[model samples]
Target chain A: MARVHDMGGLPNQGRIVMDKDEHPFHADWEARMWGMNEAMWGPDSWTLDWWRYVRELIQRDDYLTRPYFDQWMQVYAAMMVDSGVATVAEIASGKSDGSRPKGAVLMHAADVAKAAATTRDFRRPADQKPAFTPGDKVHTKTLGEGFHTRLPSYLMNKTGIVHAHRGNHLLPDAGAKGAEVAQHLYTITFAGADLWPGEGRDKDRFNADLWESYLERA
Target chain B: MSSSYDPKKITEIHEHLHSELPSDPALRVKALESLLVEKGMVDSAAIDAWVDLYAEEIGPKRGARVVAKSWTDPTFRARLLADGTAAISEFGYQGHATGHIVAVENTPGVHNLVVCTLCSCYPFALLGMSPGWYKSQEYRARAVRDPRGVLKEFGVSVGDEVEVRVWDSTAELRYLVVPERPAGTEGLSEDQLAALVTRNSMIGTDRVLKKAG
Candidate 1:
């Protein structure tokens, strides 16, 4: 739902508070929420993109009203029940009568260091020749509706130039479906004026990551 | 395994979740976590470790060190600008999000700002979790649209002659702004220079200011 989260360019989002000393988590709940999320997610299980998609799936009102970690809490609860790791009663009562979560890739306390270093390298050798090259003009294709997409709504159908070839990587659109799809990724540079016509100067630019599927030769 | 959506049951769960959820959000979080532990989904100690890793072990200071080194060392700066993943790994700061970091230098003619616009896809290992505003809908909405206006609101006024480049970070590549070194700080040590670097400066929302004599 592009109702709330796809905030690329609409305006009037009051002052940007500059807090130089900001910590990662403001409240203990936020930290624990992060921890639980870290523990629940394993390579064999869900990808962060899937979790992000679920976050977007949250109801609009709750998405806007609830604090960040609170949103995570709700998502976690839903995941537990949805995955059959826990039931509604189990979550409500704050105790678990459920069986050991099947197919869970266990992450122990000692494994935190190792886990921190592990990141899914999206890059793979090109399946075919790269679709576009640096300096080539292209346009973004506004594909897929009602589901997760890395292609921002603001960039849809907009023109950009391929700034750099970021090699082939697992496409998030296909990865969300557990497809492990590989495609060429490019750093597409959009003239700020093109994205926000009246507001941006000619020299200003916005560079975004674009998968091959999301772009076409201009 | 039953990942089907049951609206009615989900509603009940949501109601109970919010209603019975303890007033103290932290305790409520703990309660939910304990339940997960009981269900054998997560280890309590592991949770603590993960939290500590983010809260303590990783942060902007590492990025600060990188920036300081880059400012003083031209070769490292070149490497950082060319291949941030390999450059940063020399400092022992290598991990998932650090893979494809692209260091955009702040030149006299151009200034760069970083935002996800889609989601908060930041370099967590180098810069730690993003500030709250970095993930805000307003910031996300406005950053790409009215970057100069956004900069103005952040108390950063860009000159007409200078171009403002906004980087939308993705999971594959992250951008770190190597802020232009302030004048009159030629004698400062690398560590002292690192101390002057703020998270916002690295994110390109604010500039690193020089200290008074």
Candidate 2:
């Protein structure tokens, strides 16, 4: 795809082009990943847990622009930084976290283990009992003139019905919106026309998991 | 330290995390060290958890199936257009999903498109999983700004005479569009008919079971 501009033979083509490295993904990562997944999990390896991650991330807008190796590098960097093996400076500078590292890490190896054991993967329960049943019309609550929501910007103030009940979830939106939210929020279905006005396709539709705090009687 | 590292060893170490035991809960450390030696990226277990949560029904292919079936059955189609949830549940498919459903039917005069300007809220249970492109921010942003332009890029042409209805799947309900089948597929079996329906058809770019191509 990047070659298209070069084919134009126009001046400043180099300047106009974006290098693959500036983004994510190494050219060989796919081959290596495919091999590993195939060897370990078989042909359907991607169809299972691994592929889901790939599909979700690949759908992100940055996938095309990101370099292949860089993608792996970034993921590697994030996991390390997150798990406390490296610091931001070490990652940014390409310096080694060989011995000692800087900065305050809330949880190192031992700490992370203890936390993991005790904390629980809170969001793990998405298939629990739903507070609302299908066919129920619910109105989105408009809390008094102030900013608040576990709902995404697109779903706020929209009316929808309960199409399904996933049980429970961590309710990230509620967490983000500062709600005293219980985990395992309900998954609801909103109408396409209701969500987007002119843009709603005649046949296009969608659904999302939401917290109780973001909804009310419609 | 400027050191020459063999990426092969890093890959080896990564594979080790799985075969090895958790005597020290060392998945994180192993990941950290391997990353230091090699250049690679991987989704964390948190990502895996989300993927595990994803269901196939919400995937594009199965989503396309639902739309195609609705096209084949008028009574169901009408029910779907009127009340999508009831229509779909009649076929025994109403689990783990939430909110209402709206069925948008494609017609000679109308074309439909789906997008979630917010985040990706697809039906994972039934659809398997989404393609790498559906949850994209590009799809979300561009689908809203220029539905025609974006669809065109994907080879979906909207004639000037056709009224394009863009359906935004928000955090509330899901919308699945039923596209009318093309000519010359009269005696085809449902499975045969299904073969012609691509995931892109459900998204409103390409279509299903056309006459020739």
Best by DockQ: 1
Q: TM-score winner among the candidates?
A: 1
Clash pairs (backbone) in predicted model 1: A7-B141
Model 1 regions more than 4 Å off: A18-21, A41-43, B1-24, B211-213
Cα-lDDT of candidate 1: 0.78
Q: Tell me, by lDDT, which candidate is best.
A: 1
Cα lDDT for residue A96, candidate 1: 72
- lDDT digits (tens) for residues A155-202 of candidate 1: 899999999998888888766555577899999999877887776467
lDDT of 1 by residue, B1-213 (tens): 434333344445556556655556676677788887776668888989988888898899999999999989999999998898889889878875877888999988889999987667888889888788888877888888888888888888889999988988754788998898888889999999888887888989886455531
- Relative to the true interface, what fraction of contacts does candidate 1 keep? 0.63
Candidate 2 wrongly placed segments (more than 4 Å): A1-218, B1-61, B95-99
